[model samples]
Target: MKQPPAVKRLFGLYFHHFPFVMLTTTEAVFLHTSILIFAMFIAYGIYSYLPATIMFSISRASYYLFGESNTLGANTLQY
Candidate 1:
């Protein structure tokens, strides 16, 4: 048996809609970043992730500009 056309169309619209926002405040952005970093730590404990490591490296690489840390620079250089 098939659903009637009206009901099917309603379901189609409902399924395709995605309401997530693309931009947000700096604090909200950083809060999510911190949460992700914390989650990454938990994930790493379960199974190491290369992408998360690379993201951390790129973020830290900025510190090299102010001579705060060379670790990020070295990481970017290697990968």
Candidate 2:
């Protein structure tokens, strides 16, 4: 049976943007899956480590800026 026009157009678009001269179905699936997994790993790393890193930086900055003083209202006005 012949493919529908929409299916033909989709394939045309896919090939038009595809970088490789040829790609088997399995190769395409593996390539896409690897890219997705790599992206997820990067996202997970950022999600796990970014907040703690940001908080640590903020805490250090505040400590340096304010010293050990308990009087924040007065110190804030001085700067």
TM-score of each: 0.30, 0.62
> Highest TM-score: which candidate?
2
lDDT tens per residue, model 1, 1-79: 9999999999778445623244357766686688789998998776767778777877676665656565534556443
Per candidate, the number of residue pairs that clash is 0, 0
In Å, residue 48's CA in model 2 sits off its true spot by: 0.6
Mind giving the per-residue lDDT tens digits that candidate 2 earns over 1-79?
A: 9999999999899677876468778888887899799999999999999998997777777878987544334356553
In model 2, what is the error at residue 41, expressed in angstroms? Answer: 0.1
RMSDs, each prediction? 17.0, 8.9
For model 1, the run of ten residues with the poorest summed lDDT: 14-23
Sequence-dependent TM-score of model 2? 0.62
